[model samples]
Target: MTMSAVVMRKGGLELIETPIPRPGPGDVLVKTLANGICGSDLHAVTHGAELVDGFRAVTGADPFDLNGQVVLGHEFCAEVVENGPGTRGTHAPGTRVVSAPFLLREPQPVLLGFGGVDTPGGYADYMLLSEDLLIPVPDEVPTDTAALTEPLAVALHAVNRGSLGSDDVPVVIGCGPIGLAVIAVLRMRGIGPIIAADFSPARRAMAATLGADIVVDPRETSPYDSWRSVAAVSDPARFGRQTVSFPGFGFRPSVVFECVGVPGVIQQILGGAAPCTKVVVAGLCMEQDTFYPTFGVLKEIDLVFSISYTLEEFGQAIGHLAAGELRVDPLITSRIGLAEVPDAFARLADPEQDAKIIITPNAR
Candidate 1:
């Protein structure tokens, strides 16, 4: 039998029919229910070679040769249909689940979706999942919501990177899916007065809905001004101490999430932040970013870079969704079929388009 999948070629995406794969020993064959289009997916299709080169430069090895095609999708949920030979587990067929995309074949890590033709991903009718990586979705969590487990885990990990305090004023500079996820998780942790900045009005509105106490358009009004006002009321002593002030602005950020990924944003944060602030970088910036070292040195800012989440973090993401602690419904802007994936990918390139687009492979 054949299944439809969205394959990433040299420069674009194509919906192709491929043989339905059977799981090997210690593996499970999953029927894909929902797969979310990620910002990384957008980067992969648009800059396949560059991404591959960057990965190779960092890891000193390539998971897959960039010369070949690969299926794209790491954030997804599926139903187990068959447990492969020698698969030892209690999970039976028809169990809804999600898994970490990293598969450990040897001692090294192999990415499921981006690892080329050998390890296909969830942008298809079915995918082969490693048994150890599977995490069952609760009955209360819808399939669409469960599909967000991966990205939410990412957000959780990013948030964990920051040292958040009860009275610390948090700021998020970017209202993309990751930024919104950060806001949601912070709210769950009871962190308040989150100041979010974005150029897009729709994203700013979404940030407001996702528990951002204050949302500002970077193009119109500086987010620094709004956050400073709140910081003044929160900590008045900083105003009296001129030594820690930045250009006479006594307000300082406890932690700032740089989710924008573009250049200069980090510099902007460093320039405005007070001394000893922590700035977490969660965005996937492909190119080299230049920031003013003098500002970072003067502020003594702690720039922390976050990557993938741990298995425990992934489970916690599902728990939050099941417990209704995290908001997933509002993030979903569109549901598409396998055939529409190419167009959907293109549509997501628009800065003003939807937030999250889920691909339902089984849907007609």
Candidate 2:
């Protein structure tokens, strides 16, 4: 049977009809219900070659060839169709599920819908996922909300990496989906005084709706400075003298999440951050970035970078959605069918237009 899918070509995305893939050993066929457009998807479409090079550098293997077209998608929720050979089919057919975007392979796992054309992602009408990776979505969780498991898992992982303390202040420097997810997760955990900053007014408002205690426009005031109003900081500017021997000595240490992956942001955070601050970088910056290590050292800053999530974390994200502990309705700004996926990608360029766009690939 043939199915429609959006393929990433050298020039741009192309919608075409292709045979629906049959499940392989230890794989299960799934019908795509909803898939969220991630920021990495935007980067992958434009920088596939660069991504391949980076992959080569990290794993010392060239797994992706930009010469061939590939499907791009990761965050998704689907329903079980059929179980392939050597599979237990943990979930019954027609059961809603979400899984980490990994297909088990010999040496290492291949990304479900990335790396090459052979591994199609959720951009298609149907996909084959590793049976072991599938997690059944609870009956109460809607399909669109369940699709958010991957990104929310990403946020949960980032928050875990931060190792926040009860007294530590949480500051998210970018009110994008990932940033907003972090805010939501923090609020779900009962973490308070969450500060979110963004240049876009729409995003700032979303951050507030998602449970940010304080939302600031970084253009008018630096995010580092805005936290002082709600929390105590050993500020030399306020006291006319450095009260603490080091950064964050007299007050709570700020755990700043660098969600904006553009260049120069790390450097800016290092320049303005308080002493003994921990900066967790969750954003994926593809290009080369510059940051002064000396500044970080002088301020006693701990810089950490985080990516992806563990299987446990992914399941936890789904559990949170099912229990209604995390409300993600505010982050979902638009929903489109597979035909609109291309235009939706274009609309995402303007932050004011959308926060999260869910693509229903099988929609008629």
Candidate 3:
């Protein structure tokens, strides 16, 4: 039997019918329920061909060639339909679940939605997931909300990498889904007053709803000025010139989350960071980006590049959702069926269009 799926081809995404994938040893077959459209998926659609070159430049090795058909989706929630041969019944059939997107086969890493062109992902009606990567979603958490587990894990991982302290004031640099997720995670951890910046008015508002203490439109006002103003009112002595430290200068954000993965945002953060601040690059930038090393050196800044989350972090994300500690319902802007994926992609390309567009493959 064949299944319907939205496939990423050389030209663009295409809705097509393909054979339902069977799980191999140590794998489980899953029926896709809900899949969240991620910024990485958009990047793959627009610049997939350049990904190989980008990876080569970064790691001095071509990770994978995406010159063929690829199934694009990583943030998703599904139902386990079958357990393949040689797999223990750790997760029984009929369990709702989500998984880490990385498929490690021997010496190489195959990213579920991006690296392997033919690897079935959440964009389809069915998918084959490694048993090791599967994380069960609690009964309290709906599949639609569980679809956010992956990105929330990513946010948690980035925050973990930042090593935030209870007193550390975090300034999130983007209000996109990932950036918003960062804000949510920060709130759950009781680490605030969180400051977030974004050029989009809609995103800034969303950030405020997600618990950002101060949301600023970087276009109209400098985020640094906003941070300083908050710091001045909160604690004037801490903002004193002589006592102010490096990296954060007079600001209190010792840890900055760079959620906007663009060309010049890192440089902007570097220039604005005080002497000893830690900047976490949580956004996925598939293309080349440059930042002057001197800026980091002068400030003695610690730059941490974070990618996918750990297995433990993935489980934690699900737990947070299950306990109702994380709010993802607000981030879901629209829901579409499989056939609407191509059009949804087009709509999402416009930065001002929507926040998170979820594809309900089985929805009639």
Model 3 pairs in collision: 246-274, 246-275, 246-276, 247-273, 247-274, 247-275, 247-276, 248-274, 249-274
- Per residue, candidate 3 scores C-alpha lDDT tens digits across 1-364 of 8899888877588888888886777878888999999987887778766766777777888544565667878888999999988789799989998888876555765678764424677899888888887888889898889999999999999999999877677889989999999999999999978889998888888899889998988787777666666654346445322323342245454688999888898999999865667899988776678989999877778899998888899989998898889987889989999999989988886657788999998897
Q: State candidate 1's TM-score.
A: 0.94
Task: Pull out the clashing pairs in model 2.
Answer: 113-121, 247-275
Pick by lDDT: which candidate is best? 2
List model 2 lDDT by residue over 136-212, tens digit each. Answer: 99899999999999999999999999998776778999989999999999999887689899999999999999999
- Per-residue CA lDDT of candidate 1, range 1-364, in tens? 8888888777777888888887777778889999999998888878777777888899887655555778888999999999988788658999999999876566665687775545678898988888888899999999998999999999999999997876678889999999999999999899868999998888888898889999998888777677777876545654422444454645544788999888777888898765767899998887878888988877667899998898999989998999999986889999999899889988887758899999999998
Name the better of 2 and 3 by TM-score: 2
Clashes of 3: 9
TM-score of each candidate?
0.94, 0.94, 0.91
Give the true-structure RMSD of model 2.
3.1
Q: In model 2, what is the error at residue 63, expressed in angstroms? A: 5.5
lDDT of model 2 at position 186 = 93
**How far in Å is the alpha carbon of 360 misplaced in model 1?**
0.4
